[model samples]
Target: MFTSAAMFFNGAEEAVEFQCPVQETGLTATIEELMSLLQEGNSNSNSGSPNSGSEGSNGRGVYSLDERKRRRMTSNRESARRSRWRKKRHLEDLTEEANRLKMENRELKNRLGLVAQKCYVTWRENERLESESLALWARLSDLNQVLVAMQTMRSQY
Candidate 1:
């Protein structure tokens, strides 16, 4: 446990040393190393304060409870806004699709009506032709009966 604490101290000293005459990558690496050391520091009790890990020392890169909470809140708000915008865009796309489908449905209905009208006219023409055919067959049957009677009278004479 004391070894961990000592490591944390050395890591923090290196972070502060790198801050002056700052090399960007060196400072970032040292700070990241320090945070990892502190997180590995399992103290007996977490006092829920920023300085709790370092025995109340004001260390570099330590986040206070309020700052952490504020950051989390801002992050959550940004996520929520992005989600709402995505939903709104999806709904708009659905609405446009529905409108297109409705227009297509109307066009199909009009085509069906035209097909029905054509079918009715064709049926009427077929009925007229059938009636004319029946009338012609009846006249031919009467003529055949008259010819048979005339031949019988001539044979009797």
Candidate 2:
């Protein structure tokens, strides 16, 4: 009865072996060499029997499709997290740029107002100088007429 049980266990082990394979990797490598082997095996099976390579194993070597799928899911989740972080950072940069532009616009407007005030002052000064010049010219003309009248009187004497 024990012999029969042992045979049954052996048969179950063989059946499980055909279904899946086990492989190992180092903690340092992020891209697993194990997954690459599984991919290659899948491709080779579709084409023909695989060539005997350096990664030697018994016929029908061990691998787990469910583990591969799980690894892919984890990688996808990490990629999505990174993408979300990048988008958030991009939005923050845009907001900062908009605030900077608004501040610059306000400063420019203030400078323009100052320039307008200075121009108004300059115009007023110019008008005052023009009026003073016209009055001086009129006074000079009256003095010239008086001098001519004096000269005429002296000629008569």
Tens digits of per-residue lDDT for model 2, 19-119: 22333334323333444555555544333322322223445433345444677799999999999999999999999999999999999999999999999
Which candidate comes out best when scored by lDDT?
A: 1
If scored against the real structure, what TM-score would every candidate get? 0.56, 0.54
Candidate RMSDs in order: 9.5, 12.7
Model 1 pairs whose backbones collide: none
Q: What pairs collide in candidate 2?
A: 21-62, 21-63, 22-62
Model 1: per-residue Cα lDDT over 1-157, one tens digit each: 0111122233233322222232356466675667456645532123345343332445544454665678889999999999999999999999999999999999999999999999999999999988988898898889889889999999999
Model 2, residue 84: C-alpha shift (Å)? 1.8
Task: Name the runs in model 2 displaced over 4 angstroms.
Answer: 1-63
CA deviation > 4 Å runs, candidate 1: 1-61, 147-157
The lDDT per prediction is: 0.64, 0.60
